[model samples]
Target chain A: PDPDAAAVQAAMARNGQLTKPPGALGRLEDLAIWMAGWQGTDRPHVDAPQVIVFAGNHGVTARGVSAFPAAVTEQMVLNFRAGGAAINQLARCFGARMDVHALSLELPTADFTIQPAMTEAELLEALQTGWDAVDPASDLLVTGEMGIGNTTSAAALAHAICGGVPADWVGRGTGVDDAGLALKAQVVAEGVALHAQARADGIEALRCLGGRELAAMAGAILRARHLRIPVLLDGFICTAAAASLDAAKPGALDHCLAAHVSAESGHAPLLAHLGKAPILSLGLRLGEGSGAALAIGVIKGAVACHSGMATFAEAGVSEG
Target chain B: PDPDAAAVQAAMARNGQLTKPPGALGRLEDLAIWMAGWQGTDRPHVDAPQVIVFAGNHGVTARGVSAFPAAVTEQMVLNFRAGGAAINQLARCFGARMDVHALSLELPTADFTIQPAMTEAELLEALQTGWDAVDPASDLLVTGEMGIGNTTSAAALAHAICGGVPADWVGRGTGVDDAGLALKAQVVAEGVALHAQARADGIEALRCLGGRELAAMAGAILRARHLRIPVLLDGFICTAAAASLDAAKPGALDHCLAAHVSAESGHAPLLAHLGKAPILSLGLRLGEGSGAALAIGVIKGAVACHSGMATFAEAGVSEG
Candidate 1:
């Protein structure tokens, strides 16, 4: 709860100075202030928005949780390299740089061994790689993910943390139908069972069964805080990553902003756990931080409200 | 449906040539194609977006249908003049210019007469004012609204045009209470009863009991079409305006795009009556074109999708 109410109050007071009316920017005003606190400044900027796409092979792909094949992950990584994926589009949208770090939590990469999440050193090494990607002077970090059947992984991570039923959490990952959803629930249940014997703690649970990308994202969020960078969490799996980080570092939620509540059922639980509210919800199930990028407008509006709005005194307008 | 299938198909083909992936721009892609047909260009721009804000006084305001005083309608117009209103903020978001015109259909402005919807000459004059404001060279026109207790007027219009119970269409307006909503419903029922005289057509019914602003907006939408300008309809009241226009001229919907749905119950009926699918729905009940302006981002995305995405030929990328 280190929201820095004084800083928030100061930001609210400063909002009247902007060209617009008081509180007209809505949730964006809150985002700018939260960003202000994260940056410990009255002015915040995305000087360096380090975007990472955490990829993993979902066990639910075996059960058909996606319209695309499990191989789309590898193919999309090549697409990312070719600047053909939605994430590549978004990277251009924010003028942000993206890194596609292949995690060996599931399938071993071309040169790396398939590392068990249970191994503390391996988890640390994966996280360190993610942390090392972000520059020390970066102002903000945004994490996005790409994976077929990733919702199953998200549901499993949420189930592990919230002790919720897998059925209540599983949803249409990339437009899965009823039978596909049922199959997804079965696979998530299996993953939960397989990882149940691992360390019951936050980082340990992630190390045991979480995707390399998710674990790395968790590490990145934590490191962002350590580096004084604001981290904007994108969509469901990203929220799961935030939850893992929150579980590891009790106050990591302080540095995290929930970008949007994905239509995914698992998203609500993670947002609730983190005590964060999404900026918008337009039935967007598209990953690649599309919802998050759309939310930047609100953030900009909030900043404008704080920086450009005219206070009653400034406008010489009568008050209630 | 004169939806130029070949043109739309060609537009879809051209979308991938812009810079992003195919369909990465989502709804914005649709907007671009729609604009291409309306503006008859592959490169469409909202260089002069004609936004008309229609204000009218609602009879349901006496029933406590709103949070602010019904007089706030007039006050909000002044607020619009002072640029202290939400719609003004929204208009700024899109860098779109707006004109707030008071129709004689509502309560009389301090300087004008309260012309009911039945007066064709007065109604035509207001519509002309809205039309005159639009540049003939404009790519698009957006119709927005501001009226206190106007929801009651809109519900009545929806019922008259779309055919629905006043109760089903009634809800909290401007922060009304349970009793206020009940009273608003009673008033709406009365208004509908009094205005039930219809000639089996939308234009006739609207003229009999519609607010001045609603009728003017309806006129603006129609005029925009005659001028080949596509209309972007805002929330509840604006939808009512569009329905009126649709009733006046069949296929009016062809010239229109529903910007966003409102939380207000009347919106669905209006949307249904006009046969439109809204682009966004964020529980927006405030009607100063904030939702429309918010949708501007989506529109920009759409235009960007159509204009910026790289074609397969250019990218040398393989498709599924």
Candidate 2:
């Protein structure tokens, strides 16, 4: 289903009537109009926003592709539950309902450098877990991931689906050094080389090269679209997951906004490939939906100005 | 007084100890540390952010330099007072204390195309009005403006002090058309040529070409620097006011950050001249400190992540 065109029209009319000059609020006015279409209201408010973080362990950690150990995934998930992580603070600050799902952190995915990252059944279950995680009543959705060495899997997935070389898709994830970056690129090449057929099918690529958390993000994004909930896709891993959906079905990401381009070198090019402009770009790379979670404030400000400002007539201010 | 070096060092050390990898927070980490230095604490928060909107009338409207009538200045000030403007909503959304001051709205400044915009006495009073309006206890300051034909005055000021052509300093302010834009550049050129002596002195340039509201903004920014309150400069007009301060004394704007690059054509080059990279580029052209007010949320998020997140040892998350 498409956005409500009538609501968009009403919002656009109201935006012009507001006290400032037409389009002076810039992208914020556009954001508010976008929210209006998705929420089916001329005056849209994101009263209920959901932030779901899925955690999965990656066997690719064995390749030493990341700076942190795989155990840190479970630890960070615990930190989230304890409300001690950056994501927790940001979500709380922006009034988001945050939930954490640990998808078999004890069961590491098969390393795509050697074999498929997940069996078909495992992939299906992970996607199902993501689909079920979204709250249909929530007006906005933000999906985050917690996994060590998942960036390597994301790089391989992008290489497979986006037709980029392994080097173009690889970057220093979680503060890897020069040697580690080189090794990660080599690993992405090997994964893409072995899973050649995956390049033609996004879902097959997800099964072959993406971890549970990445697949879960794809599922959550897809569900958000069905529920008419606007999605703010996070950095590299989350974007790659969303890219899988776009690759599987072009225009699947029309309801989504790129939250921010991360410090990861691949993120800029990836966002360009998707033709999505990011809301914020502060070089953030901490991928627990931190950037998007922070951007919740930007969205709220946009909506508030669009809805709350007085029209020229109401304010008795003359206009051209 | 300069920012506290000891506090900055302490904050940087604490940042490295946080659960995330070093520098993953990107420019936000820098913002947090900058906040720490200004607040003189290892854990900095903008608890009392003061948003001051100074409104005045510009005689330049006589030159058909603006889309709105001069009466709209007072009307918009009333709009600000009634909480019916975009800046009001943004400040409220970000939990800032917003204040509106109309600096002699009934007495429009002299048109700079014919003569100096203000006498030295009048400019000093306007500057004093701005300097006195800032609350010394406030931790952060954002100065906004509401004046008809003020962008023309700002363009003239930037031209005299920043060594730019009038065309380079003029834009379609308040939604003026191409003819109005040309007229505005001519107005700026005439003002700068007549007051060419102001080219060497920012204060002189401000007196010759800047409106009361712009002088007030300059005064407010200077007072903020003296009080060690970090300032978030708004779009073109506000940046021009800050540029006057920087022109009077090099490095005077070290305590300020460019809040956003506005849709006004002159803003980007003006910011480049000041050597300040804007935080947001949303094409926002609505003054009244709307862009900077919106950025209050970003500063809060940066502070929250820097101050509220648990350290690696506290969260029991492994660090390199």
Candidate 3:
């Protein structure tokens, strides 16, 4: 469903009357209005935001594509559950409710360099898990991932959907050295080439190249879109997850925000290709939705000011 | 006093042990270390951040240099005190203690195009007012201002200290039209020309070209520097105020962070000149320390992740 047009118009009208000069709030004004339309309220606010971290193990980890071993993905899920990860701290700091989902960690996805990463049934189940995980009461959503070799899968997804070579989409995921970077790029090239159907179908790309957690994030984002909940897309891997949706159907990400460009080099070109401008350029490379979670504070301030501030008339201040 | 170096090293060592990959947290890591050094704690947090807003009237408003009337300054000050302004909401949102001080509102600063904006006594008093307003107990500080036509004052100050021509420093402050922008550029050029001594002396620039509120911000920033309280420079005007301190002495803003570059065109060049990279480029042009206040969330998230997250040893997760 499209955002309510009347609420957006009303938000714009109210923003103009705010004490500050028109457009002085810059992208914040646009963000507030965007939220207003989605929430169907001229006064937009996000009191119950949700941060979900999906964890999956990748068979590509056996290829020396990642610095961390595959078991770390499951261990990090436990860390998240124990509230000891970076995402937990960030979510708590921003007053967000956080959840972690570990998907078939014992059964890693197939190595995409050799064949498809997931069967259609596996992809559908992962997407269903993501869709069912979203809490309907959430006014805002952020989907993040924890996977050992997911960046390889993400790079392959980008290479497939955006028609890029491996190097353009690959980056040093989780502090891999130069040789690992080169090897990951080569793996991405091979995986993307082997899955030619992915280039023609965004959903096909998910089955052929993306990991389970990445598929879950895409499903969660799609659920948010259907529910008219505003979404803040995290760094590179998460962006690629959402990009698959946009590729399958253009404007699928219209309800989502490219929260920040990560330290990953591929994120910038991917954002450009999707025509989304990230609000933050922080050098964050963490993928537990940490960057997007931190940005929750920014969005809160925007809505707080939008709803709480006095208008020119109410303040009895002269307007320009 | 400089930041505590020992604490900084301790924070860096702690950051390396966090569960996430090294440098994965990006500039958040640096911000945490910066806060740690200033607060003299390995676990840095901004529990009692202070936001001070100084309001004054600019005599240059008589020259049609602003879209807002001079009377709007006092009115906006009332709005701030009434907790009805954008800054009030933002400060509240970030859990910062908000204080507003009206500095000789009845006595507008002299128009710098004709003569120095303030006499030696007036500049000293404004500086003293700013210095005294800061609470020593607060760990973080952000100084903002409300004054009609102060952008003209700020642009003039930047021109004097940074050696830029008027056009290089002037911008559409408070939504001025093309003609108003041209007039502001002319005003800045004339002000810089009339007060040539300001070009050589940063303090002289404040006395000759800066408004009372701007000088107050400079003084407050200096106080934070002395107390080793970390500061977040707001938008163009606030950055200009802090630049005055840096001009008087190299590394004057060493304890400060350039929070964001504003919509004002001069801000980018000014930040570049100072060799400070802003964490945000949100196109926010609203004064009253709004931009920096919005950034408190980012800083808080950084420190929270730095201080609260468990190490790989504690979480029992494999390290990269």
Candidate 4:
């Protein structure tokens, strides 16, 4: 059975049964129902949606593509662990759990104790780490990343996968100006050219060119899909990891649903390539699963629509 | 004391203090916090949010200005009362109360079996009905309308209040084409000319040309302000009623919050006249408090930002 196909069809059917006009809730209606199908039930509910925020030190941060200093990556990860960031506040609002992991990829030692970057030989161990971290009963997994200038890594990964011009995929990272973006694009183009042979190595290509958290997220998604767990993906950065993972295994996206269509221009194109529909388009550019946490309610709403709505037959109302 | 001004300022201040970047949440940030200040508390929540739907028979509907028949207004109200309409489903989702009123000035009946429409003599009663219907302890009032050619009524009312040319305020209502809109503008212009003398009588101008709900909602807002209740307003039709009330009593809009910036071209000008910011900019042309219901979450989010977020001092984080 094509679980993804069956799941998607089930989602659409749930949306059709909602009390509002068909498609009245727009992208939100689609997302909630899609999540319902992925959970394989009409009464889809998210209890303690966990946000796994993985922070990696990207070699690309050496180049000045982002507004913040590269040191901010580990710093923000600590802030996340301490529950002092925007995403942490959002998680508290949604009553979701937050897990912070520092993946020591480029700089083997950060001030904080870091998880191993995990060499090719240790990939199995890393995968097991991911598996043990997630609850099998989780309704959803939301993976986010913290690495200064990670957008540059994301763009490079997108370039390697799509074979599209790197300049087209690049954008202002963390409120960079036009000139900064131009520099960012030039850096991505050079990085893609530099990493061309590595991308040819598949997952190894990802390890060499992608951020540590992104790769870990890829591993997490693979494990989630294997365990039949569903994932809610955030903006462009997370989408990049999902795309790279999908390239490794053709249907990896089968377990994934998009949370928001970001204002970042690259996000829409990347989501389009992945063939995923985003739930909200509020011009949100914040990372760290902010979109995903907010969207948990929408999925809940969809479940409510399917289960809570008294059908026309039940409400004793004539259907036109 | 300008209660409205104080409320507006408190809202702005509370929003600025929210956890996100100063203006990152955009219009939504403003809406939720504004509501908190209006409610005179930090933890602003909507319990029993009521949507007062006003239905009227418009002469413009007689001129074929709308796609649906004017008879649909009464039919939809009955549908609403029967809990078989789009608004019914939304009200159910939001846990809001729905009240439909038929204006005696435009409807076939004046008895109390259904809601009574008011004449000038019963203005105080109409105002009190709006005030009493809103629960004293409730957090918000959501307003919507259902007159087939209501856009024509809205445009004319808008023209009377703000003095925009009829063409500027006229637009497609329920999929009317360019030609249909042009005809609508001409009809509105004629109506405006015919009612020019009533301009001296602010409420009279509204009564002679406005929809039943428009007048009642005007009374609603005026009463809501005196009662210190907050009103969450819907699209163009409701906005026109709001503008009319604001023009009559300068502080009437103080207790009201615009729920959306509709695709209706007239809405922006009317909003500018009212000097209020709408919470959402979804291109919703439907005027059933649907946009308002969606925006409620945003308001809640803002309130959370104000009441739930720790100050820089409280969080003990460096904010330099």
Candidate 5:
């Protein structure tokens, strides 16, 4: 569904009369107007915001690209279920439901440096799983990922889709030392090179080089856009999914908002390619949708200001 | 009251045991530790965060230094009271109680370009009023202002305290035109020159050129520190108040956290002088304590993560 152009115009007009000087609210004013358009109402309300964490395991963990072993991925999934993860606490704080989908944790993606990460059928199943994860009643959606060593896969995919060198895209995932970072970069370069033909094709790139979690998040974002629900994107791996989705289906980001600029080195370049400006820059690198959950309240405040602030005439205040 | 160093160390120790890699949470980890220190507990909770907006009138409005008239200050106070302002909505979203203090808005401050903005007695009273406004039971406090031309007063105060020329400190308040900005700079320069001696003294400088709201905010910050409650400093004007308090008391900002960097040019310099890095940088210029109110949720999430996340041992996850 297309955003309501008329509602956006109405929001802009109402914002001009909101008792403050013109443009005093800055990016907040833009956010409110965007919400208005997305909701097809002059007064949009943030209701039933949901955060979905897609967890998977990556074969690249064998390459020592991440600080933690691949087994931590399943362990963190159990932790999310036990309500002890950062995303769980943050989701509760925002009154957003938390959904954890362990997408093939028992069967980790193939080591992309040696072979394609997944076959076409496995990639299709993962995408379908993500598409079905969205709740119809959800007014807003935020996507997060929990996969050990997936950053290496994301970096390879980003290098393939976004055309950056592996060194530029690879970062210190989970606080790796300088030597580990160098090894991670080498692994990503080899992975991208091994899948050069598949990298030329968008969907094939996910099958060849991306982890299940990244592919799932890409599917979820596409589904949310199709359902006309706004998606708040978490850090680098999630954004790499969105970047690939944009490659396959352009304009998929019309319903998405960049929650924060991740501390990861490649995230800035990815966001720059997507032409998105994040709401927060707290140097966050946590990836279980924690940044998105933290941002829910800020987005709510923007919607509240759009719907609740009195006009200058109502407040009897002189306009600038 | 000094923050509890033991609690901070304990919080840092627990952070290392979280399921993710060490320092993966970035500044969030620091924020959680700071909260623990400030609250004097290993598990600090942001239970009753409060936002107080101190509204006043600035005499410099008569010189066209601001886009809005001075009367808008009182009107905004009424708007805040009626719960129809941006701060009101943000407070509700964060579950924070909102308070509006109208500080002698009927009698605007004296024109600082010609004479002192307030007498020493008036400045003392304003400071005391702000001190008294802090709720005894509140765990966190956010300070904001609602004066149209107070930015000029704040710029003048910042210039005096931080020792920058008027051109360096003055900015477009409430979307002032280029000509209006030039006039504001000229007015601030003249005001600073007129009170050069008082400018050498911190509190005396506030009396010579600061509006009642800024003095009151300085007072509130000082009182919050004395009471051991963490203060979330708003944009330029509020930061100027914190800067002034720092100069007078030398350690007043020990309990303060910068909420965001405002669009106002003077705010960056002011924050740099105070050795503070803001959490959000949304280019917000609206000052009804909105930025601080918006940040309450982020701070709360950090605290929640610190207290609720599972340790690596608890989750059976191997640390790198």
Candidate 6:
């Protein structure tokens, strides 16, 4: 569903009446208008914001494509549940509830370098699982993922959908050294080349190269769009899933906000393709919705400005 | 005085024990340590944060150096007092108290192109006014400014302290057109040239080329440092004041944080010279401490994570 144009118009009108120079708030004014449009109201509140973290294990860890072992994914899930992770602390600070789901941690996907990551039926099931994770009462939904070697799978999937060289999409995952980074790049290249023809199709590419967690994130984004819940996307991995979802469902991005530009090499181009500008650029590469959680505060401030501040007429202030 | 090294060390050690990857929080970890060191405690809070906006008028506004007229400064002061300005909204959202001071607005400073902006005594008084605005009970101090054609004065000050050409230090202020920007650059060049000998001295440059508000912000920053209250520096105008403070005191930046890289062209080089990295890059150009207000939330989040998160031993999570 498209955003309500009349509500967007109402928001812009209200912004003009605010007792400041025109366009003084810069991107914040745009953020408020976008939120208003999505909420279909001139005054919108960020009610029941949520950060849903989907955890899965990537088979590409077998190729030594990551700095950490695959077992860290399971451990991080436990850390998130214990409210000990960065995302957990961030979610609490921003007044957002965090939900962690270990969808396929015990059953890792097939190694994409050698075979498809998952079957079509498995991909569908992962999507459904992700779709089910969304809270019906959530006004703002943020998607995050925890998976070892997932960046390699995300890179391969990005190479398929974004049609870039694997070297361009691959980056240092979990602070890999020179040799490990080169190994990751090579793995992504080989995987993309292996799934060349099937990758042209979005679902086929997701099945061939994407992880279970990524599949679920894309499903969650689509479902959020269907429910008119504004979605805030995290860094590179989440943007890759968003790109995949956009290819399959053309208007999925209209309901989403790009939270930040990651330090990873692939995020800028993907964000550019989506016609979105990130609210933050902190060189973040952690994937458990930390960037999105930080951006939620900014969004809340924008909403407060839109809804609570007095207009120029009300304040009896002169306009420029 | 320098930050407490022992407190910083304690914070870093605590971060290491947190149940996440080392450096997983990226710059947030650095922010917490910086705050802890400044506060002289392992557990630091952003208690009673305050935003003080100094308002003045520049005679240079008559030369078409800015897109807005000089009257806008006084009008903005009223807007700020009436709680309808961007800074007002942002301050309310971040839980920071907002104070607007109209110093020298009724008596505009002399045009620096032909004469010094203020007398030595006037500059000293302005600095004292800024120093007096500091709230001793507040843990955080944010400096912002409101003055028409102030960017020209800031650019001139930047050129004097940082030694750059007019074009390098000048930018479009308040949405100036190309012609207005060129005029601003020319005005800055002439002003810097007129004060060439005096410009070599830090305090002399501030008196000869800087506005009353800039001088006050510098005093505020220095006072905040003396009181060990961590300062959050706003955009180009505020950063120019910070640059002056650093030059005068040599180590005043130790207590200050750059909030964001403004859309103005001169801000990046000023920030680089201070050896500081901004927390946000939102392309914000609006003054009045809006950028600093936006950044307070990030600082609050960093503190929350530092003080409230569970350690690895406490959470029973395995370290990588």
The fraction of reference interface contacts (C-alpha pairs within 8 A across chains A and B) present in each candidate is: 0.03, 0.74, 0.89, 0.06, 0.80, 0.50
CAPRI classification of candidate 3: high
Question: Model 4, residue B135: displacement in angstroms?
Answer: 3.8
lDDT of 5 by residue, B1-320 (tens): 89999999999899888877777778889999999999989898888998999988988788888877677788888899998899999999999988889999988899999899998888999999999999978999999999989889999999999886788888887888889888988998899999999766788888988989988998888888888899899999999878887888777798999999989989988999999999988888988898999999889999899999999888877776
- Model 2, A243-316: lDDT tens per residue? 99999999999999998889998899899999999999889999999999988889999999999999999999
TM-score of 1: 0.78
| Clash count in backbone of candidate 5 | 0
**lDDT of candidate 3 at residue A216, scale 0 to 100:** 96
Over 4 Å off, model 5: none
Better of 4 and 5 by lDDT: 5
Rank by DockQ (best first): 3, 2, 5, 6, 4, 1
Question: For model 3, how does the per-residue alpha-carbon lDDT over B50-103 read when each residue is reduced to its tens digit?
Answer: 999999888889899998889999999999989999999999998999999999
Which of the predicted structures, 1 or 2, would earn the higher DockQ when compared with the native?
2
Ranking of candidates on lDDT, top first: 3, 2, 5, 6, 4, 1
Give the true-structure RMSD of model 5: 1.2
Candidate number that wins on DockQ, 2 or 6? 2
DockQ for the candidates, in order: 0.18, 0.81, 0.88, 0.20, 0.79, 0.51
Clashes of each: 24, 0, 0, 1, 0, 0
Off by over 4 Å in 6: A273-275
Candidate 4 chain A worst ten-residue window by lDDT: A108-117
Query: If both were scored by DockQ, which would come out higher, candidate 5 or candidate 6?
Result: 5
Model 1 / residue A113 / CA error / Å = 14
Model 2, range B127-235, lDDT digits (tens) per residue? 9999999999898999999998998998888888878578998998888888898898888888898988889999899999999999999999999988999999999
lDDT of 6 by residue, B1-320 (tens): 78999999999899889766677677888889999999999988886999999998998887888776688788778888878777887888778988888996889999999899999899999999999999988989999999988999999999999986889999887788888888888998899899998666778889999999999999998889888999999999999988887777687688989998888899999999888889988777889898899999999888888887888788766565
True contacts kept of 5: 0.80
User: How accurately is candidate 5 docked according to DockQ?
Assistant: 0.79
Candidate 6, chain A: TM-score?
A: 0.97
My TM-score estimates for the predictions, one after another, are: 0.78, 0.99, 0.99, 0.75, 0.98, 0.93
